[model samples]
Target: MKRIALGVQYDGAPWNGYQKQLDRHTVQDQLEIALARFARVDVATTCAGRTDTGVHALEQVVHFDTELTRDTQSWVRGVNTFLPDSIAVRWASEVAQAPAHDPHLEFHARFSARARTYHYVLYNHPVRSPLLAGKAGWTFRPLDVERMRAGAAHLIGQHDFTAFRSSQCQAKSPVKDMQSIRIERSGDAIVFTLRANAFLHHMVRNLVGSLIYVGNGRQRPEWIGELLRARDRHEAAPTFMPDGLYLAKIDYDPKWGLPQEAGSLLPWFSL
Candidate 1:
């Protein structure tokens, strides 16, 4: 059997979430169905991370084991022909599929991931833009980017992120290495870029909400440090909307040779 890794991009508004469900109304369900039609057989898939409903992905990495042989381009064009316009296979790569006992060499999509980067786009204007509807988080209050940046700095290391975790999260631990958090603003658009080893459910949204409070002067920058030490979910701000969140990238070892792209958090804006 051969393991095929696929780079996927999706709008995420039409589907319930990334994972399959009994109702079969999800990104995974749609992708698997398209794979079945293209290959003329059932194809189960595993993703690097399962995004929540309405959360988009610029490039989501997924993998599946198949005995059927096909060229990489065939997997991209062939599967995409059966997929919806909102979802498309951007690229494909075949990786080493080693035995279960020797997992170090095997390239499991989720397990092999080295880090993840998420981008949260916010529209800070009194009047919302029709063009950004369903694409960005909106706040009528003015936000100070510098304050947000100061608040974000408090979360830039390995720590227990229980304050930012959702109650529904099933992560094994709340401790994660928060590599960096960069906040920038261009015109009315504010973007928060976070890179980490991994994230807890709703962690990014919650962090953004808390940072928004800081940006709006509702909370002091030092409050972020207090929240971290408190480790209580109720102490933090509410979870921000998933509409603005994008799983921008799932980083892996360079040896894998996945054809991924690099760009600003928002394609148009530069930090």
Candidate 2:
């Protein structure tokens, strides 16, 4: 059996999340159903990341083993035929696999990932836009981008992110390498881009909410550093809505040759 990697994009509004559930009302359930229909066999898939409900993904890498021999494009177009309008397989490629006796070296969709990138788009206008209701998060208060930047700066580098982690997070550890955090505002829309080696549950949302507090002058920028040092979840801001969060990209080594699209927040908060 050969391992095939697929690049998938989906709007998470219609599904519970990326992982499959017994209720069969998730992105993974839908994708697996489509895959079985296309390949005429049950196909199990593993994803690079598991996004929360209502969190979109620009590119989610998945790998599955199959004995069927088909070209990459066929997998994309064929599986898409059975998928809903919210999800589509953008690209597919055959990847190397290690022997079954030593599977640790295989090109795993989740294990082989080097980094993850997430974007949060927020509308800072008094009145909410119906056009972007579920597409973005809305806040009535005016946000200071510079203040938010200063607050975000404190989160850079490897640190124990317990203050930002969710109680339900299943991650083995709270220590993570926060590579970068970029905050930009285009008109009334503010975009926050964050990259890390990995993230705990609700980590991005929690961080964004705290930064919003700093932006609105509710909390001082220095408060973020205190929160980090304290490592107390209760001292941090409440978790922000998942509507604005997007799994923008998953970084992997070049050997996999997966066709990944560039990350962007266009037509809304382009910067």
Candidate 1: segments with Cα more than 4 A from true spot: 99-101, 263-265, 268-271
Candidate 2 Cα misplacement greater than 4 A, ranges: 99-104, 265-267
Residues 45-83 of candidate 2: C-alpha lDDT, one tens digit per residue: 999999989999988999999999999989999999999
Residue range 1-271, candidate 1, lDDT tens digits: 9999999999998889999999998999999999999999999999999999999999999999999999999999999999999999999999988878887899989999999999999999999988987789999999999999999999999999999999999999999999999887889989899999999999999999999999999999999999999999999999999989999999999999988767244675455
Candidate lDDT values, in order:
0.93, 0.93
lDDT of 1: 0.93
Candidate 2 lDDT trough over 10 residues, lowest sum:
261-270
Question: What is the alpha-carbon lDDT for the whole of candidate 2?
Answer: 0.93
State candidate 1's TM-score. 0.97
